[model samples]
Target chain A: MTFWGDYRGHGHPHESSWTMLGPLVVLAVLSIVGGFVFNVPEILSGMFPIKEATENGGPGEMVLTGISVAFGLAGIALSWLMYVVNKDIPEKITSSLGGVYTLVYNKYFVDEAYDAAIVRPLVQGSESVLWKTVDAGLIDGTVNGMGTQSQGVGSLLRLLQSGNIRSYATWVVIGAVVVIVVMGVTR
Target chain B: MNLLEILIALPAAGFLVTLFIPRKQEHLTRSFTLIVSLLAFVLSLGLVTGFETGKPGQQFVDNVVWIANPDIHWHVGIDGLSLWLIILSTFLTPIAILVSWRYIHKQVREFFAFLLLLEFGLIGVFAAWDLFLFYVFWEVVLVPMYFLIGIWGHDRRIYAAVKFFLYTMAGSVLMLVAIIYLYTLAGTFDYATILDLFRSGRIGLSHTEETLLFLAFFVAFAIKVPLFPLHTWLPDAHVEAPTAGSLMLASVMLKMGTYGLLRFCIPLFPVAARENASWINVLAIIGIIYGALVAMVQPNMKKLVAYSSVSHLGFVVLGIFSFTQMGLDGAVYQMLNHGISTGALFVLVGMMYERRHSLAIKDFGGVATAAPWLATIFLITTLASIGLPMLNNFVGEFLILQGVAQAKFAWTAFAAIGVILSACYMLWMYQRVFFGTQGKEPGETVKHHMPDFNVREWLCVVPLVVMMVWMGIVTQTFLPAVSATDASILDQAGTASALARPPVPPTGGITHGGSLHAR
Candidate 1:
């Protein structure tokens, strides 16, 4: 058995693409007709369960299904005819089809459009800049400041331990006051 | 005897044991905590098996007179509403302790002690039948969790801890005010008595006053549910938290919000709840979509899962507000589903982080070759979180969507986007982490470097994996237990909405008829 893509070698293999259109169109029509037949009953039933309907076949149902099948076949034939007519066209026309295909493939650049509209302003805005800068500078700076402040306080406390006559007198007075405050509070 | 006291006491015993255990013997502390948690879990399991689903309501009624003069009783009970949530909490705590056995090195005894203490508070909150005891337990949950986050957390631990503490504390304080007001009206501190009065229309509240009280409770629950906009603190907490901390926080602690909404907010203020139901669904719908969109763009895997919690829990809120039997059931189911799947994801993420020391998705690649079992577990869990059919998440999410569909087609339609976005982000993350080559080229360094699942990791995750499949297939086992509570809540919703309908037509007719006569 020959597969669909297996016959794509030399000599008028390109013509086979046009020949394959007839059955494709016929199948598409049959599917459309089948879908309409299935769906028309549902629409006619008006959202109610099938059990609710007193009778199944009315004149309206028969006519609707008939028209659906007719339209399906017409659609199939037209599609096949179009495919055949377009198949032997010039390379330029074929390349334009590829271009159209590419656009459809890329979803018509909706993502790019969204980026241009929303993300650029969000990323480039002053608030973002401020957030980034403050995040890096102010937040980190404060953490750094705490370390430096602790070190500076330790150094200042170290300086206090240096012995001096004035300091000694102050220390004695402070000790006397502490004792006095303790005595007063207790009393 | 009400099982409530035992629920609180079992963990209290664990907490007491932790104090006596020398702080230096970390292994002993963990083993004791694990045993205590196992005891509590067994007790919860007893509740699950013996629980009579259709019994009038609020089983194992443990009411005792704590204060005679003021008329406050130590009232506590388990009901269809809290039964599973309590089980989920107790089940995870022991697993959490086991997960932390190797990871936490310093002050390990203190860590396990805080974990048990935290479990005690959570169980107490769920089991408490008295308003005051409920409030006390609500605050009890905060302190241990605070220490857990602050003491054992990662870089910026203090910031995350403070943020979590402040956010929850601020919401809960207003809930205290609301509780006091309800107490004043009811002249009692028992939840059953207050609910009875509120339901009977004996406790009078103007629409404005009721709406205010509802908002107060809603805000507290929202912060716990961490419903969107109020959910800013969660990612930071999840990222900085220790592995077990993230597990309990995501799985158990977050349910406090939805639990409050069901147990307190809706039943107490039926009229106001009905009035705000639409608006609340709008918020929930926004959360469902917004969380997914945010998660889709996250580079960090842990934060991505954290944000997905926001998305997934939004479905729970949607189900609750939907006020349909299916919706409410789905909401409760989703709550459990979120805990299991997201908890497993966090554990998996934590395992990777332990090995690589990075949460960035970009840092991982081609790990499937080296760590096939780990990758496989992650894949199953990722599919579950994405609500793929035949997984636990699917049942809850599908029920939620069905409930939403019945209430409002548009709301469900909007929520459907979240499902798509979830698949996109989760699969993309999985592909990045596992499916491709680790290094730029297929080299020996990348091929054989990453270690796969070890014995400990396998033990930790095997139960979760089995559950993810079992719960997904046989959700009937879980759903029937919550059916009675869901039905009652749906009835209340119907009554409130039905009452509003009669007034609407009369007012519309009066205005139209009066204008016609004047003309």
Candidate 2:
């Protein structure tokens, strides 16, 4: 990975200052010497109990430690050979990994997953379902529906509003006949 | 003249005066409206200073016969519950005036006139002790708010205004029918007289009649609170309303609904309130969670704040229905807290709108960098809104949750999620607006139009922020009066204020102890 940078035969030395490197120097010393002098995990454990490492039940701790160190060194060697010796191999390996490489490179698609499950659905639902369907469609629809329904009834009744006296006489006669009939039936 | 009479009259007089102010003299119009509202606030403070705590009753009362046949009276007063609410109305009126000072350029005279008229309606709503008078004040609030949103608002203002008007009118009409029915039975619209008649059993309501009446008043109030399914109008109203209009609508107008629930609905029909608590609580919880979930995805800022109101007010509704003194007190306190926090949120939103002429979240980036002072005030308000500990909302929400836990622990657990979701939406909206990835290279709007807080903006915000802190930390200044009033409300209803002292199991047993007035 270091070899992957633009490393010319001769490089220009960058400007350095105590304000910049002074902290770096202290951090470097702390990273090395602070580990033994002050154990962070040990200190933190008193306040917050650290979770015990899982028992894989495959091998003992000693064997697992040795295996992890060996694999770490092998990873360095492999990276060196791929990047320094032949830069093309890294790309080839990445291509071979394909979807897995993409997934891991995007940090296991955590942000994508969150967007898909929570964020996008909420936005889509709010816009399309809650706002559009429930609010604009159902609630407001019912309210407007009442108005339109009344108007429809009025339009039907409007036909009976003919100014002609003949139609009015007929409605009056029909009203009298229904009243008499209902009165007689009740009697 | 009685102080309450003067408090009500000052705004009415100011409204007429502002109406006569030449529309060309915009500065005079603004300054006069501000002065009137400031005077109203000052007079309202007199109520607080003279307010005798540890008494749960109406004070500074004024009565006069306004109508003969129906026995309607111009009755008005303040109580422990309505004291701060009245003050909240008076306090926010000037803020609303300041909010609209520069923004409302076209209808300067009429706008200030309408703003003063709105203050009058709001103060009247909190003060009116007679049912007819209350109804009048309630309907009066709608006219100015409708005009505020309609004339001064953004696109679709007409639609939002009409919808807001119709929704409130629909619910209030039912309430009117109920009020008339009560008057027919009791022979007067005076609240105290009717209470005396009902308590003495001279005026009786059968179970069915009581339930129906309760539903009528509750629906009216619920619509105002805009609980859940009925709340579709609020987002539209808040989003379409001008800055000052949104401030008043959120801060005081919405409290009218919760206030009605506490003042009229529960006291007049305690049995029905108790019987219906199960479903009302259900609706409130649904409102809490649903509002938060819906707000989480709002692309627009005003709409987001509007939905958050739905979530916050849900706690108030829940508290009201819980049938415990703690619950009632919490509900009342929460009302004041919501007024301060949400009112501040709307003002802040309006301030931002003034800069960019946009309410869309995506239109903003690096606001904190551009306007650090604005961002700082906004952060304080946001924290206050999300019920951050030692803020106004925290006290209200905590008391509400504690009260609910005593009545029904399950509800507290459910309602607590809303508290969490509140933080999620508010902070997320805060982040996207103020501290976006565009901070490195600010957007065009952020670089050019957005500026730090002006004197007027600071003046508009700082007092609300101060109140938020004051109400949060030294709750004793407010809560004792609220407790006194709520205890009286429960007592008058023949209810044990401290019902279910042992946190009863949710096995149909909680209401047994809570409802001494239960049929």
Candidate 3:
């Protein structure tokens, strides 16, 4: 009653936790009565259809089965209690599990460790010594020097292709005069 | 037509068809290329259906004399080693075509033609059963890749392309010399004949010759594998290349080296392979750890992925040298898994690039909200790349580990670290891209009004997602085909020696040393 809200069921005699608790209590009582009165074999057997042996051949066999049944019943009771306790929990309690979930989802910073241990050192070392000195200094430097050399050669080549028609004609005339001079000298 | 002949000839036909594509209607030319590529793919698909998994030696084999003069024949076959690789190359090209559909607007005819030509070369490499033929296919790959990068790549494209070409060519030249020498010794270019001769000890090379030839082949394969110290050119090529080019290099091209090692070096020269196996194992382990460490720190996502190839391919190398059945199968499986998973990854990364025009990991966050599909695809591909159990990568990695474990405990332990490192980098990259706020700064055209993947992107991704799941679960179909071959490989490695030992008798039981191999 103290925990009851302003809903219409508040004042009703039947509407209480005791009322809900009554059925479970009655069921337990009925089960005990039914076990002795009807000698229900199903009740005697937990799940399997086989009947328990009644021979008092050994205490050990009885003790083990009894322990097993006790454990099973205890597990059921504990689990039910857990269900009741956890059923009304709020989102905050549930989402607290996300912390560990996120860590797994992020796959635990092994990449960072590898980077620190191996990649950074190798990349840095190579960039400084090998790449700069050999790859760039020797390889690219050699290639670039070739390019610069090609440009030097290219400029000299361009001097030959200058758009001077008169120079071309003079060169042709000079070649002819040289040919005539050579022919006359030979004669 | 026989499957092997069809496998070889279909692509050659495609190569021919691509030539006849009219220059005027460039779109028509593109359509022709697509049709030819689709035809080749269909022919390869015929392989999956017809492939007999339990029987592991060569199947659908067609060998015949092509040259009468010098004793060369058009020999080709598909074993477990070559089967999936052929399928993977065939599968990716059409998708590559579709991806390039919009992006490669300029030189429409040439792009598709080169791609088709490239497909032809790759298929030839996978199916060639002759040493001379294999080397021919090997060198054939260079031209298309060079053009693909040089013509279409972004920023210093020519430089990257030339470097790639030069490096591969230099390696191949030495390999060529080795191939000729092998031909001289064996007096046949036939692969099976040479392998049989090698196994029977009929073909013998002097120790110096063996070392030289091994070095020749090793240098060639290593550059392609781009094992640790020689791996410098990879990042540049990957970063500068087009999406399809990057995908091709990461998924397929890297495997060429490991495949060469298994096909040509180890089986052809088992003595030398066994002699130098430990040194190879050491280098492979270094590549594994070193690649992972470097990948972990990469600012550029493409560079990270490129470095990861070095690591992932390192596993393939380790698996190869483990000299166990599990190891060889794992190496082959890893090769295929790398193709599927990494191919999917590059595709997704390409979609991201199309939107943002940047590959810097820090450039965006919480993209999951805008493009839920993109985020989901990226996450799944990332998981596969990380080799999560039930995924395709996991099976291969697990097998490789078991193989290495049986051989050397310390090697297996070090390789396991690479596994942990893989999970680290992949998951970290995933979180940074998908979680937190989904926005970018102003004035960056790509990011400012960046819309998520449209219909085209979804079409590209859905198949990859389906494949990732399907290949993961039904790995039996893939595994069974290779198991017999793997067993034979283990037989050669003497792995059966240890396997034959009886299980340790339980406590209080008599040890059965008399009949150890009985069980």
RMSD of each: 10.0, 6.0, 12.1
Best by lDDT: 2
The stretch of ten residues in a row with the least summed lDDT in candidate 1 chain B is: B510-519
Worst 10 residues of 1 chain A by lDDT: A126-135
Model 1 docking grade: incorrect
Writing each residue's lDDT as its tens digit, candidate 2 over B1-519 gives: 788779988999999999888878889999999999999999989999999998556888888888987798888888898888988989999999998889987888988899889989988998998999999999999999999999999999998999899989999999999999999999999998898787766777877998899999999999999798789889999999999999999988999999999899877887777778889999999999989888888889999999999999999999888777788888899999999999999999999999998998988887998899999999999999999988999999998888888888899999999998899899999999998743345444367689888899889999999999999999999988889888888776653212312344666543642433321
Fill in the DockQ of model 2: 0.37
Please give me the DockQ of candidate 3 compared with the native complex: 0.06
lDDT of each: 0.81, 0.87, 0.76
RMSD of 1: 10.0
Name the weakest run of 10 consecutive residues (lDDT summed) in model 2 chain B: B495-504
Stretches off by above 4 angstroms in model 1 are A1-187, B437-449, B493-519
Q: What are the chain B TM-scores of all models?
A: 0.94, 0.95, 0.90
- The sequence of per-residue lDDT tens digits that candidate 3 reaches over residues B35-143 is 7777888888899898887675688877787675555767888877778888888888877877776777666677777787788788888888888888888988888
Q: For model 1, name the residue pairs that clash.
A: none
Number of the predicted model whose TM-score against the real structure is largest: 2
What is every candidate's C-alpha DockQ against the true complex, given to 2 decimals?
0.05, 0.37, 0.06
Q: Estimate, for each residue in B194-295, the C-alpha lDDT of model 1 and write its tens digit.
A: 876765657768778888999999999999997866787788889899999999999989998999998888777766776677778888887887677667
What's the TM-score of each model vs. the native?
0.74, 0.83, 0.72
For DockQ, the strongest prediction is: 2
User: What fraction of the genuine interface contacts, i.e. the true contacts, does candidate 1 reproduce?
Assistant: 0.00
In terms of TM-score, how similar is model 1 to the real structure? 0.74
